[model samples]
Target chain A: MLFRNILFFMGESWKNLFRNGWMSLASIGVVAVTLFILSVFVLINMNVHHLTEVIEQDVEIALYIDEEATSDEREQLVENLRNHPEIKKADFVSKEEGLERLRDQLGEENGLLEGYENPEDNPLRDAYEISMHDPEAVSSVAREIETYPAVGGVEFGEDVVENLFDFTGVLQVTVMGLMVALALTATFLISHTIRLTVMLRKREITIMKYVGATNWFIRWPFLFEGFNLGLLGTVIPLVGIYFGYESVLQWIDANLKFFPSLIPLETAMGQVIILVVPLGMALGIIGSLISMGRYLKV
Target chain B: MIEAVNVTKKYNDGNQALKKVSFLIDRGEFVFLVGQSGAGKSTLFKMIIKELVPTSGTLKVFGRDVSRLRGKEVSVLRRNIGIVFQDFRLLEEKTVYDNIAFAMRASGASPREMRKRIPQVLEQVGLKKKVYSRVNELSGGELQRAGIARAISNRPAMIVADEPTGNLDPQTSMDIIKLLRNINVKGTTVLVATHDQQIVDELKKRVIYLEEGRIVGDQEKGAYVRAL
Candidate 1:
């Protein structure tokens, strides 16, 4: 197309955008509303995947030593556990050192722990605070250690760990499935909406057909409308998400401080744009193509 | 230049619009296809522009088979032949300039060329002063002139007008035919399909008469034979 033709088509498409004012507005509204929900889920899915990853890497297993185990036996247990293939690090926490950590967690309540200050009064057991190369192997490794004679109990938060794994697994799949469904529904809706606008121009298309206009010439203006509508529709929601997600992240930071750090604003925005803009454009293209196929047989 | 050798078109309902129709139109010739409402005049004109292909026989325009033309090839064929319609099939809400520019742009005329040529054609059609007037604002004659201006604006090798003056008064109708005659005199072939006997008898041009889906008469400077 000539530069002038492109400019003409752009002007024509802009006019078409307002030709059926309510129809165009409705099309844009559909895209914006659909993408708004889509981006929220996409964000949540990303953050959950990120947070679970952080937790998975940092979770460790703690093995408690029996009171009857002598210092030498405790040393042997630690040595044997360190040699375990799945164990990354098996540092021993003595009863006194364990008391120190308890006091740190207790904060102002540490004065109540003064009763256990004497050596004989210390009732805490020696434990091996073990980290693993693979967090998935934590349960199996802890269970095996519990069977050893020197190990009294293994506490890597069995119930909490199982539930966290279950929750992350289900949430990841469900959110991902929901995102795909939303995108498909949005595309289907936008295609049909644009078809109505194209239908309104059936006679105009017939006139163009007889005017010796090439199929491409007849299609260019509509395609331009589709491209721009797609662009504007998807961008509107992304803009909403851009401002909204920032404060939402702030709230999460203030309250869910224990959760792993999330995707930053710029990265998340870039990701959505990259994934979303083309989909939006495709929706418009498919829509106009289908409409034209019916009315523009020439 | 069009050649139709036994061209036939049958509607799906088995109505035979044209039966073994054959005619040859030379370059720079002005021919009027005159017939009753169902005499297949419009269908012949459509075949010339490749809007409707023959059901069986070969119809050639500019020495190429029309039915063989595909996609953009058909558009290229139409660009060489401008068409004017009775109802003034135009972008009605747009200015007279846009209506003419449409045909020019369809053939991919540049902005510079359109700027330079639109006025020239409009001037030739006596519409120079009304270039920006909306099409719906024009009188019947003026609308037909705008239609003629658009037809000639592309500078096609030929012009095809189907009932070009159907809605105009007798005087306006003659004016439109003369305008088309003026275009034809400039050495472009012109084919007009109409039942208007007044202009046909008055103009004394070549007339091809059709009856019952076949050409019943063909004469140089032929007179329209009125139905008894």
Candidate 2:
């Protein structure tokens, strides 16, 4: 653990890492591919989460007012809806707007709505449309609004809102599950690559043991190799992520506008770098320990 | 110093590699453990280093029972006994200087100490001219010399060379044995296990002869007698 021992172990590991050209290269490549797979899933998970958030925003309740209610009472209802803790947004639709929307819907059939053109004759009532920050609370919020004397009825299609929440929750959980499995796969994949290098130098380890090296002394160099392989392997994919991810986002923005807008490059990359780089290093260390376990007994 | 009293090693397959073999090697003595293949010289050497614990009876190195040494204590025991192998066993990819430095580093020598001590070790073994040559690039004699340099770099109290000149030519063998003898003269106890009758007879040091996992002869300044 001293600085001197660390320096020597690092120097020894650096040489052993390249001792077998193909074996070392192969280990690095395996780490890269496994990490790259994990990153792709992470990006997918982030985008899906973003899309679900956008959909949740559109899940609002339409509360029509009783025509018999006074203007002051309608105004008070709008204010209360807006001030509620869970409410994210509220919009008041005047009776005239209600008529206007009906007219637009009946475009080709204008003659049928000719009598209803006047605001007084319009059948639609003034309504307040409100959405909650958490879509899961839609039904409870709708039920609470229904208790208002001035409010006619609340309609937010209970089944659709519940189903949307269910679908998004399942998607997020599945993606997270996949990420855990991928991380484990990356560890084993990296370990297998490191094992080859360990075998190539198995004789060297025995000689080290014969030379009176402590188990730690023999382990330090291989640990260094494992750590380096993982770190270097991450660089390939991170470089792939850093320079290419933004351009991929731009391409999606131009060609697939209907798709949910992906998280901004800077934010997505921050999340990925924090999670993946350490993952790579951890995988490397674990891999090295696994590969070295049987050999260090001498 | 090593002491063995009724030491026996039985493998899992019930084959006894050593049968109550006992001997005492005092400090600063040169001894040749001479035996044929399968005669248990290797097993006895391994027991001294605590690599293989005795199945029965007691074996002590440095006055402590080796069979009772724990993990870290085993390393301490080994560090006190420098071992040489028939194959030279130097890391093929490393230079001679680095090979000896490995031994010093294993024994926790400081960087400054290693730098100061390596050249001296190389000089003692006559490996100074090829100090930077990779092990694979050296001739058989030079490799053996580098191995010896590494074995003595840590200044262990005893040197256990298991067939040190096993793979060398007759002349190289003689030279390696002479170097070991010189190190012994400098007060480092030396134990060499060899089948070479010429070196054993020529040196006429304390010889312990083994046959079929049993010590048949032990004598002061003994010749390579096959227990006649």
Candidate 3:
């Protein structure tokens, strides 16, 4: 009996959808447009998070060791830096290796500083590059490292790190705020549109009530109608995101080699698919449920 | 069977629709509810279906206190009683067969049952040939007959026809009363609320007459009485 009722509701929902083609189309269109806009924001949110990770990698403290210090002293300083609570990693870079890295960067201009090529003649000092778990903790960790005996001087971009933290905090808050607002707006619009379909068939609903239909019996078809509308709304946006994002990633990969940290379309789309389809359907269901709640008083 | 004891309905705007009105309708009984516009006939019908609760006193239908029924229980209560409106309330877009089938569908009747029963009820209402005809295309008399078919399709214990003949001519009205009379003969209780005094005189059925929300006259085989 329950199964038959469900089948009947589903059949009725399908009939109503086709019977009111224009209204159904209009409802689906609303969901599609709203979900498309939401997907775009989700894409932007992923890229922003990716950018934050990339910039976080650059937030390291550079400490120059005293040139006269012994190799044992340098190793002890590296050990102390690593054992610090805030520091995630601490690695020693010899003066010779630093010069080699500089030369590699200079390429053809390596010969411009010919006399300084020798290890003994190299002006660079041995340094301990420190990476911390929290970007905000970098400054405090650097201050602690400065008190070490063999440390010559400590340098890290204080203003740049502070600004990065502020920017990331504000961006995260704004994106989250926008997402919640958009979700609510989408739910509201979809529900109101579905309500139009309910209003059109109110007479039928009343007749059903008069004939002793359970409230759930009357609501099942409407809920299914909402689910169908929500499902249909996601199709275009999913296609756009899957294909459109892939092409954008392909173009970026070809033209912008420097931005290797940007999330690839495949990875981004995995999240999008999981998020978009369910969100669209949920919004659709929520909208329909809200409208139906009013009429189900019968 | 239905019982009403000291039933009073007071709207939020302070208009007392029914004041200390009480009556009993036994099983297999045909009753006529005759009243003017504000004489509380509609309110009484609504209370019987559990649509509106009486502000005071008790109403019991089928041995259950109707005022206490809630949600699904109310639907359960309504299923045993069928109602017909003056306007027919047929879905104009649907055919006569679909309209009758829809009523059975509401109560979770199987498709096989609907198929078997729709034609039978249509035949009873003398619209078996017009089964596939759309409600909008049917004559007023045929439409009322369709409404009757839908109401009796479920075989409820009682049938309430509120001014069923109000929109029809005298000959058609008599035809509808005869149809209701036939259903009553089959032992399903029937109640007809109407202002047509000529039919009341002709049929000589049990009549409960009301004025100003009070029952002034109730007589078996009664005529429509007007106080000078």
DockQ of each: 0.63, 0.49, 0.63
Off-target runs (Cα >4 Å) in candidate 1 are A63-88, A92-128, A133-136, A147-153, A157-165, A168-184, B226-228
TM-score of chain B of each: 0.97, 0.97, 0.98
Whole-model lDDT per candidate: 0.82, 0.83, 0.84
User: B1-228 in candidate 3: lDDT tens per residue?
Assistant: 989899999999999999888889999998999999999999999999988999999999999998889889988877888889999999999999998888888976788999999999988989999999999999999999999999998889999999999999999999998999999999999999999887788888899988888888789888877433
Model 2: per-residue Cα lDDT over A1-298, one tens digit each: 7799999889978887777667667768777876786777677667666866776667789998997888788778877887899898888887788777766655665566678776668888888878788888988989988997799878885675456568757876876777567666656765666676677777777766766778898788888888998898899888888777789888876665345577898898888889789988888899888877754555
Candidate 2: docking tier: acceptable
The lowest-lDDT stretch of 10 consecutive residues in candidate 2 chain B is B219-228
Per-candidate clashes, comma-separated:
0, 0, 1
Q: Which of the numbered candidates is closest to the native, going by highest lDDT?
A: 3
Q: Report the candidate with higher DockQ, 2 versus 3.
A: 3
Judge candidate 2 at residue A289 and give its lDDT: 87
